[model samples]
Target: MQVNLRFFASLREALGAQRQLELPEGATVAQARQTLIDLGDPYASVLAADRAVRAALNQQVCEGGAILSHGDELAFFPPVTGG
Candidate 1:
C-alpha cells in the first residue's frame, strides 16, 4: 500500500515537506516510522525511537498503533510548545 507522508517543523527541515511511501498492507503508523528509520541516515536519526515526535493520521492526532490505509496521510512533527 502507498501512503502520503508529511514532515513538519524540524522534521520538515530534515526530511522535506512531504513524500510518498510504500508500506505493506495492514501497516501501522509505528511500522511506517520504522520503515523510514530503516532507510538510515537522517531518517534514522530524526525519527529515532528516543525522540519525542508527534503524529497525525488523516489530519487527526493518532497513536503509533493507528492502522494506515492506502493513500492515507500520515504526518510527523516535533512536539510543539507555546508561550
Candidate 2:
C-alpha cells in the first residue's frame, strides 16, 4: 500500500523532505517512523524518545497501533504550542 508521509515544522527539517512511502498492508504509524529511523542519523536523532512527537493518521489522531491502508495520509509534527 502507498501512503503519503508528511513531516512538519522541526520534523520537516529533521527528515530532510516530505516523502511518499510504499508500505506493506496494515502498516502502522509507528512502523513508518521506525522506517525513518532506519534511514539514518538525523531521523533517529529527531524521533528519539522525547514523548512530544505527534502523529495523525488519515487526519485523525491515532495510536501507533492504528491500522493503515492504501492512499492514507500520515502526518508527523511536534506538539502544538501557543500562548
Candidate 3:
C-alpha cells in the first residue's frame, strides 16, 4: 500500500518535505516510522527518541494501532506546547 506523509515544524525541516511513501502490506503507523527513521540524516533528527513526535492519520490523532492504507494521509509533528 501507499500513504501520503507530511512533516511539520522542525520535523518538516528534518524530513525535507512531505511525500507519498510505499508501505508494506498491512503495515502499522509504527512500522512505517521505522522506514522513515532510515530515510537520512533529516529523518534521524526528526525521529530522534527525545522528540516524542506526534502523528495524525487522515487528520485524526492516532495511536499505535492506527492502520495504514493506500493514499492515506499521515502527518508527523512534535507535541504541541502552547498554552
Candidate 4:
C-alpha cells in the first residue's frame, strides 16, 4: 500500500517536507517509523525512539499504534507548545 507522509518543524529539516511511502498492508504508524529509521542516519535520529515525535493520521492525532491505510495521509512533527 502507498501512503502520503509529511514532516514538520525539526523533522522537516532532517527529512523533507513531504514524500510518498510504500508500506506493507496493515502497517502501523510505528511500523512506518521503523521503516524510515531502518534507512539509517537522519531518519533514525530525527524519528528515533528516544525522541518525542508526534503523529497524525488524516489530520487526527494518533499514537504509534494507529493503523495506516492505503492513500492515508500521515504526518510527523515535534510536540507543539505555545506561550
Q: What value of lDDT does candidate 3 attain over all alpha carbons?
A: 0.84
Give the per-residue lDDT of model 4 (tens digit) for 1-83: 99999999989988989999999999999999999999899898889899999999999999989999999999999999999
**Reference-based TM-score, model 4:** 0.96
For residues 1-83, what per-residue lDDT tens digits would candidate 3 score against the true structure? 99999988888876656988898888888877878777767777668656698889999999857889888999988889977
User: TM-scores, in order shown?
Assistant: 0.97, 0.85, 0.88, 0.96
Candidate closest to the true structure, highest TM-score: 1
Greater-lDDT candidate between 2 and 4? 4
On a 0 to 1 TM-score scale, where does candidate 1 land against the true structure? 0.97
* Stretches of candidate 2 exceeding 4 Å from the true structure: none
Query: Which lDDT values do the candidates have, in the order given?
Result: 0.97, 0.84, 0.84, 0.95
Best-to-worst order by TM-score is 1, 4, 3, 2
Q: Any runs in candidate 1 off by more than 4 Å, and if so which? A: none
Tens digits of per-residue lDDT for model 1 on 1-83? Answer: 99999999999999999999999999999999999999998999999999999999999999999999999999999999999
Worst 10 residues of 4 by lDDT: 39-48
Q: Compute the lDDT for candidate 4.
A: 0.95
Count of residue pairs whose backbone atoms collide, per candidate? 0, 0, 0, 0
Worst 10 residues of 2 by lDDT: 43-52
Best by lDDT: 1
Worst 10 residues of 1 by lDDT: 73-82
- Per-residue error at 26 for model 2, in Å? 1.0
